[model samples]
Target chain A: MTSEQPDWIAVDWGTSHVRAWAMTNAGKIIAENGSAKGMGSLAKDEFEPALLELVEPWLSAQTTVVACGMVGARQGWKEAPYAEVPCLPFDGKTTKVETHDSRLDVHLLSGLSQMKPADVMRGEETQIAGFIAAEPDFDGVVCLPGTHTKWARISAKEVVSFQTFMSGELFACLSNHSVLRHSVAGKAWNDETFETAINDAISHPEKLAGRLFSLRADSLLHDLGNAEARARLSGLLIGAEIAAARPYWLGMDIAIIGADTLSGLYSRALELQGCAPRCPDAENLTLAGLAAAYLTLKETSS
Target chain B: MTSEQPDWIAVDWGTSHVRAWAMTNAGKIIAENGSAKGMGSLAKDEFEPALLELVEPWLSAQTTVVACGMVGARQGWKEAPYAEVPCLPFDGKTTKVETHDSRLDVHLLSGLSQMKPADVMRGEETQIAGFIAAEPDFDGVVCLPGTHTKWARISAKEVVSFQTFMSGELFACLSNHSVLRHSVAGKAWNDETFETAINDAISHPEKLAGRLFSLRADSLLHDLGNAEARARLSGLLIGAEIAAARPYWLGMDIAIIGADTLSGLYSRALELQGCAPRCPDAENLTLAGLAAAYLTLKETSS
Candidate 1:
């Protein structure tokens, strides 16, 4: 964006948390800060100001700002439309978000312009952009597993539609808060159990939805230890995701981006599905996308 | 069991809550009270005083008490032995409980006992006894569905053995507290969607566990409304329980117990399984069980 040594403010606003990074023109982190409070909390107006405080140290008279995530959704400050599949950085409409400080010209990055019956997403648009920046010529599929695990088929710089799975959220709720908690211990995972569940699920997918109750009975009837049960439950959920994401992953190389604990799970799961796994450095992609968005905005708006 | 009408105390103690019912000689309610503090709330000593206060208003020198539930568990006042299935009143041990009030003679009922792999229950034993009191000659399976649904096979006035399913608890936590909440709207049941999930589960029993992630995806893909999605999710869970409970249900008639709203739901599910449904009144069952336990104690002892 700015040719100056210190340029724009980069933010990744997620559902449960917010992460902000101040970057120099050369793409080095000037400063980084984060908060547990995310888009799920606060009124839309409170968002920009709260974020401003975190990057206040770096905010000068002309610092360009770009943000991604649910903060650009319908519930966000302004609804950023979805960018359609198979496109490059911030393919959707970018908005000039309101800021308390006029000196800080913030460019809220538009998400992907997804066209089906509707349009959606603000954050993943940036993520896809960053992925393209890092691997500009790559063409395949990327799976981002979380509350909603999104599997996108990417060709060149654009996302060619995608499928979303509720695997992560279901796993969390079923394991921790539901009766399955007694059956499945916790975060622990066992490979044997995982593989067994995957095979069981893949073979009889129609029964996959109903097997949740057996988690408890299986634990009580036999000693399906907590770790095995948890891993088995994970397999059951992610296996379902693989089924739903099949159309997206068909004939495509799959790259998974997440922390080691989470991405490793997907990698293992992908391997089971006979797909090769590509594990990328998440931080690098995020910064690359943010910088790319800033660069795009600088060129277009200048 | 007491020939003479003297004030009686009936208690249902469980892991986390304690409920006491004060009844007349003829089982008419004199008063009732409860406490959030349960066996889980205190050590052995603290139980007496806290329990005393909960029923202090009806406490008198002439009181003969028979208590049920976890008050007799390993964590309660003293470990009460379990009553084996085909549960009849007094099948369990009679543990003479000591208290600070010399005037009050409390006979804490025994928990349902299993000698083999060793599993038992305290409060549910009383509930089964109550069910028997309501339908003294009935023989089949009675399901007390809740956070833990207990299915007991009754014959010859003995319960044989019962299996507990954590159905309601799972349903509550998922609908109210989990990410699936966003995917599922409304709390009411939708028979069509529910039946689909149930059939899906039944068709492929093994994969039932894995299909759970489909709730959110189906919601997103298909235009099923949230209320229907919630009901379908619930049906998916309960169907799994039905599958697990298959052993206990074979050759046995089904009696579902709960408020009409909940019990009706179970009845419909039972119908789906081709089992006839009979719902005995639940409002009076707990108290009736206490009465049965009291009467049994009176007959065997002085």
Candidate 2:
């Protein structure tokens, strides 16, 4: 909506949504917009129109568009194959898209994959890059809590290895689709209950499946409140993830990069295990990561 | 429809479906029917009509209909309060429901509950009772694997204690709703892959959350087939359950009562841990349990 013309575009195109920011050549934001036309909802040819729907007003002459996330997936407009891990987050290796509009020069960033554990991440690599961009000398684990939470070991500005946990997706599925849906209906939370559940799950990770059904039993027999049930479910899921991820965060510097609410829970869970983690605002980091990619592309071309 | 009037009716009304059998006084089945009108689908007031719709043709004057399962839940036709465990699965403790039609005399069976660990079961109690009826000396553990799998310790024909696992529901939720849904799409299964996954999960129950995500990653990177992914998912979940229910099955007489496919999986998983479990057909046990309750009622009345 800005009257001034933009120099380039930055897009964080994920599975369910597409976020775009019109930025000056200096990385200063001019305007921003987003749409529900994410990679999941769009066909191969529809990506251009979906992108143009949001960034059309900011466009002038030929402008470079840099994007990250699932837009680089196989089903995306153009597949930006994953780069193996134990390398830099981003190094100007982007997949160029052939667009109909001459004013659009689109580039999708490469995601990172690990060969041994057989894991791959698309959007998170950008956030990790942004974190590295902000803290070049940062050496430790970067925990990104999200739909598929990622735990990456970073050393000397390089991603050594990473693991992904489907805790967020599992929470969504359990709360909305599974039998626990009836028990955890409300949005209310109990911190004490959460802590207790986390401790129980972390201490006895094997009992998790049985403990899950106990939520429904507690609701039926003991009148466990919906809020407490919700907290307990979250705590239990996060606790299990933490139990498995102990080796990654145990005795290492940890920074949790995500939204306040999820990050807060992760921070509290880590604190319970005698480790302190720094929570960084997720949006800023995503934008920073896109900008980092943009700056690299510009430098290489120049 | 049968020309002869039935002596009584046996019903297993669960969350999603209502199954009925027209039985003679001597427990001879004359006809059987089922409907989608489960306790979950019908309101309290509508339960009678739904029941009559399926059993009306089989009903005779003043027929006694004994039903089990979620039909006795709080939201069911009439709340059959849960009986605490350490007692027989069914001991003629039935909740009588007032019906509009004089021809219908409905008695809903009480489910079992455990207070300490907090667990409850509706229809599985009937299956356990049936198993005990067939093997009156079943002095070990009875495992009923279904939507909410139940593991009950049976001693002297009593359900001493029990635990419920949401592994079935978890499997349904993850394979149908989560990111893994895309990976595990076919009905195909691999026994070897399933066995390997079970061992992996049983050995390190803590790594379950991480392993779930790997299915998706493996599909993307290593061309993991849908059948292999599905089998692996099942193995991991059931293995975790076995790991937690070790106390219940280890060095004990184990009887698995459920549908053939699921019961077979539980049997195989238990066998992997050096336990030989007897797999019994679940339907026969339900009818046996109902007949047991019906006979007890008739004896008391006479």
Candidate 3:
């Protein structure tokens, strides 16, 4: 807990975890904490207590709290609703929640949605807002890799369109539940093997179904190393994603916002295809985006 | 239990279950039984007891038992090494296991392996053998759809080469373990929806990564029914498989051997691609193959 009282609080609550930050008036983070209590685990009435438990020390009389991510989802504390595409990432359109405690004023940020592709994103929109906030002139495709990676086209301070890929989730499911689980049971990796697999998948995306079983077969037949099998599995899934997302990244300025390890793999795959991508720290962007939303809430109230 | 003693026992011991049939000297089934005691659950020493528990009433003095499937795998009861491809599915090669009871005389059949692409199959080999035993001139591709679907190119009573696809397992993994689990719950299926998704995946296999997420997005945004989602998920995976296995099925006589529901889906998907594949009952073929192996054992012993 921080000695100084927080002027406001910023929260990024997602599916599996909740993260909070105690911010000063000038957007300085005085303290930070997180818990496994995420949207997926909590009930509608339990959100307030879960949040309060994490940041009670920083609370004061009439302190305003601005939250983003799944906290604003339909099944969340309050449905902030989705602001469709061709709109700014954060345009002061937030859902204000009526808390029982007089000192607690909670506001949830709206996520972005696309109608044509039938795609929707929560939490990621906040990260995009932060990326745009940091580089106002950044106009290109922004790829946010996670359980479900999102690729959004940003132009003129608005999201033109976006697509979502479940490659990360597919990788996890296949490596854990499928027959390949026994072959790729370790965290070890082989870069050369990964590169080869990426090329194979990119060239023949149709063969992905057939190629997946080869990992297990090779392990059983020629003693294919667990690391190589692991790397190849990752490469195959990511390569297929890159192949499907060609229109988004081909001959376009690109920025990849994700964790170092995953972003690095994406960077390597793209670089193999002769494209360079700028990678930004994901956590910092989330914090920056939440702070931006907090500033907007303060302005509207004043 | 049957009053008459069995001459031999035909067992299809796979990963999840052990099925045994008491056979007469003239290939007549007197009784049939199975248990959850699959090769996956039994240790090397425990396989004898599991087999005895199921066939104790049928066993007599020196009862010959012919077993196939994962029972011959390296980790199974006895290691019956894989017989390389371009060879007969089950020739005269069989691994004999020493049992504690003198009444039990057991032999495990060999699976097939492909060296170039590094593929292997255990239980499906017996099915292929059965297919060949029934139709002695099946000089084309034999598709066995299951947890791990196998596509074997047959030529002149030999398995020239083969490939394995995890589409079935992939479908199970994605629907049960991935984020799509929430959207694709239940068994309701829409044929029209399935057909459309099949064509989409077959045409643009590269776009599969992008299309998968749409199932979830459509469910969330447009109320895509669980039935439609389930069918679409199955279609996309099976379609991708058909696209990948095109080289094996193109212009070649195709035969699908599996359970009714799964084989029907594969047949439907292939029919959309202008190919008519023969659907054979998987159980009858397994028994025929095991009987063939038993006959070979009797001849060699005599």
DockQ of each: 0.20, 0.90, 0.90
CA lDDT of every candidate: 0.71, 0.92, 0.91
Cα shift from native, residue A195, model 3 (Å): 1.3
Poorly placed runs, candidate 2 (over 4 Å): none
* TM-score of model number 2: 0.98
Q: Per-candidate TM-score, first chain only? A: 0.91, 0.98, 0.97
**lDDT (Cα, tens digit) per residue for candidate 3, span A250-275:** 99899999989999999999999999
* Alpha carbon lDDT at A221, candidate 3: 93
For B1-302, candidate 1 gives per-residue lDDT tens digits of 23333468877777778887778768887667788887867898998788777866665465777777778876688877655544475563578888888767788887665444334455776777788877778778888776667777788778777666666776777677765677775656677888877776555554443355456445544555787878777777778777767777766877887667778767777788788878878757877888877777777776
**Which residues of candidate 3, in runs, are more than 4 Å off?**
none
Evaluated on chain B only, what are the TM-scores of all the candidate structures, in order?
Answer: 0.85, 0.98, 0.98
lDDT minimum window of 10 residues, candidate 1 chain B: B113-122
Candidates sorted by lDDT, best first: 2, 3, 1
Write model 3 residue lDDT over B1-302, tens digit each, in one string: 68988889999999999999999879899999999999888899999999989999887688999999899998899999899988999978899999999999999999989999999999898989999988988789999998999999998899999999998898999888887888999889899999999999999887888999999899989999999999999999999998999999999999999999999999999999999899988999999999999999999989
lDDT: worst 10-residue window of model 3 chain A: A57-66
Worst 10 residues of 3 chain B by lDDT: B53-62
TM-score of each: 0.79, 0.98, 0.98
Question: What share of the reference contacts survives in each candidate?
Answer: 0.22, 0.90, 0.95
